[model samples]
Target: MFLLSSLLCALAGHVSAFLVETSSLTDLYPPLWKECPGQFSDYRVENGVYTINPWLYPERMGMYKILVTFTAEYFERFAPNNEANILWGLPLQHGWQYETGRLADPTDETKCGRENGNHTCISVDSWWACMNYYLSVLPFFGAIEAGVLGISSDQVQLLPPPKDQMYFCYSVTTCRSTFPETMTKWSTFFQQAMEPSKSWDDLLKYLWDAHVASIEEGRTSFDDRSLYFPKPETDFGKSWATAMNYIAAIRFETTLQNVTKFQKALPPRLLKPDDPPYFIEDFTDSQNRFLFLLHGLNKMHNDSGHKFLSLFRNLMKSELLRKMANTVLEQIILDDNISPQELDIIFSGYI
Candidate 1:
């Protein structure tokens, strides 16, 4: 009996060790995230990186992060976000920390050598500094899209949404990069679809019709992925329940994958010679819908700035908006304009 008890103890210890040492986000991934509620108890080590998937507690469904922490040697070389609150500040308590395994510049391939080891590859730099450069520098172009090209903030009669919404250009820019060719197609599509309209409904119908036509032509285009619509409910086609389900699906499928890190800026695109990949994950559909909704709200506020916020809040709960989206998809049929070669390019871009 004593031998059996001793073996059981040993087995329990081994199981505990495996749980802590695993690289993936063990049992921390919750289907729905709430506020960083309970104490953060789970921690696992994967591929030399420590990851906390659910982190503290999730308050929202779409806000989880996986954090990675590096070893002492690598931490000394490539210092990542180590402070507890820093990673938790992100949405959904979803984040990761990498103690090591980050290359300095995309051009520099050598690993930052171990502690006290003099290495030629180790460049004197901070991860924060590198991140700052990207977020601050390149993202100006996206701001130009919303601020200069789309509409100026000065003209905006309504106070902007929290920085969480208005300052998401970095994420949009990254989304654009994911499908450069697709974006090119989108640019052309939006250009044609953006013919001056009297109301938001007019703008939505124009784009929705175009999308349906594109799909019929064998193009895998989205219905409302580009947030360019103004009035979402000129025509109704789908039930509100269906629309909510769609939104939930969009949130679920779209996730953030940390390709690289930067301080407060966009990092240099690690995948290519000239580009710094934008950090942060986003739902392509949600980003578009949010943008379009904002643009429409901006216009409404301009026209009737008196009740813009109230209208927006109401619109959030409007069933007509969902019907408009669904009606557009169901009403129109598309013919493909993109050549077979263009399709090939689009396929390559996703990879």
Candidate 2:
């Protein structure tokens, strides 16, 4: 009975979300938002084989674009326009990293990410970019392994940046052999996602499991990369990584619409010194408000033991509960009082 109610509510919420008419970011960022690679030929091709160096921002993003294009069918049951495709998170995150200067050369040794130099270069020196490579490149490989790419693994070659040759794999065989456990998780996700019996929840669970595993496998590899940035950016990285743990457990929606909504919570630019979570010294009022919520969520996550986890997981399945949560937040954002009766109406069932 509870499940039925939640499913109904989820359906309504999804419809309402779609009707909101959220704008897509197509050409907002120059050069970085060139074009999605519809086929292997759109990439660098030589003698019928494709060579892609993911270190270059466009090439790496192309990998994600192709993946999204291929994976859209699996998510068609959820929303129109592939707006519910779980893979949207990968490209959106990469774009955010690029926009926020997280992909730049941290040591200032080279202009790898500078406008004056190779602006779209994914700097090997940036810890954020290195960590993101695992998320982007691995899933791209897994899509091929799962037969979604329509291109054989042998037909494509992935190149690492000039220096960090040991951290990446050039082909599906190399990737599967190099990171067996991580690749297994991701491949299992893509394989299972294609199964007809998989539910929305099942897909989210599989994706989140793979996503977290990728982070676990790749995060420790760049411990020293933290030394490249000042204290503020370093602190933001720690906070952001920890925040993802909370997000992973809830299986945050990675749909195009949801991602658009989620990305709004992030600071539009690079974090500046003294721009703390609670203050608008550098960021806008809304970004700072969202930052406060992140800190609050982080605190509640730590203090509540399994309580926060349980509630978060519960909230994911129910639209009314989500509406209730949003209502409270909306009131808070408006600096008005939250009405308990309104929330009671939203949470009318499963009591």
Candidate 3:
């Protein structure tokens, strides 16, 4: 019977279709799956119904079926236990195994904000909330990138950046030369933006101040060279500046929220509890900050024609997606008897 149950679980991993319902507006981050190679084939929400393409169609050569049911409260309270057992049960499954966190017990009086949202009342730790926040902003970036690049909105593909475009990460050819030039210059400038040997709080302060300064500087530069790109007919420089500021500001706010959440209560697995303890203490507060800073600097690099956007592109292509999944798993095994490294391998090798 256990074997049969396991087989059923295995066969049921391909949940290409699902109906997710939540109580409030904020409780609306739908479950998602992404196995497709090129396209943003993972998560798309339309008309309040989310679709996660398992990418099991053409490759697997048959229709596959799996059950994905999410209630925001259930996800918050029991995600860790459910994810660990389910993922362990069927390592060969096709969807992501998420293990979200809990604040206290499910029946606690806190009630939090959203009726169906996380019990913790903390915003960032709520996986569904974070996902919703990101999904909301993606369209804005899509619109702006299109107008600035002088291409149709559809031309700006978000995830798995087009296979054809020359990239520093996914493409072996581009990384050899193009990437280094872009990344090196940006890294050097970014280091200057930071004060040497500062605490996380200090570092964050530095970042916020530097970014505000950069925005002012960027505005001036735009005023000076406003005549260069996209010809005078389209007013592309003004559009680009507006779009760039929107992107930068959004990134800063999101990064600040994310950093604050992870610092408060990141899963123990992401940081080895056994390792010096302070290392985890220092980093839980600071890890994702670098990525945001990297992204902001990359934006400046592209706008300035520094070519460093290529390095950022490469890093995303190779590492970002995997890193995100690893983070999800990290929370599950926190302070538990599991080898995170081995589990990462199992995750990478299997689903």
- Candidate of highest lDDT: 2
Q: What are the lDDT figures for the candidates, one per model?
A: 0.28, 0.74, 0.29
TM-score of each prediction: 0.19, 0.78, 0.19
What tens-digit string does per-residue lDDT give for candidate 2 at 57-95?
888888888888788788888877777888888888888
TM-score of 2: 0.78
For model 1, residues 1-351, the per-residue Cα lDDT tens digits are 999999999999988876665423333332233333222132343443323221112211121222212111112222222222112222211122111212122223324322333221222232311222222212222222333234322221111212222222223355345434433333443343223332333333322332223222221221232112112211111111122233321111111112111111111111222221111133222222322333333444445543644554455344566556444322221112433234335434332
On the 0 to 100 scale, the lDDT of residue 320 in model 1 is: 68
Give every collision pair in model 2.
Answer: none
- Looking at model 2, report the run of 10 residues with the lowest lDDT sum: 22-31
- Identify the leading candidate in terms of TM-score: 2
Q: Which residue pairs clash in candidate 3? A: 169-314, 182-308
Clashes of each: 49, 0, 2
Better of 1 and 3 by TM-score: 3
Ranking by TM-score: 2, 3, 1
Instruction: Write the number of the candidate with greater TM-score, choosing between 1 and 2.
Output: 2
Worst 10 residues of 1 by lDDT: 233-242
lDDT of 3 by residue, 1-351 (tens): 999999888666633222121122113211222332222222364543323321112111111111111111122232321221111111111111122322111223344323465322322222222222122122222222223212232322222211222211222222224333323332232343232443433323333333333334335322433322223211322333333333332222222123333323322222222433222344433332222232344445656674444444344343444355336423542323433334445444332
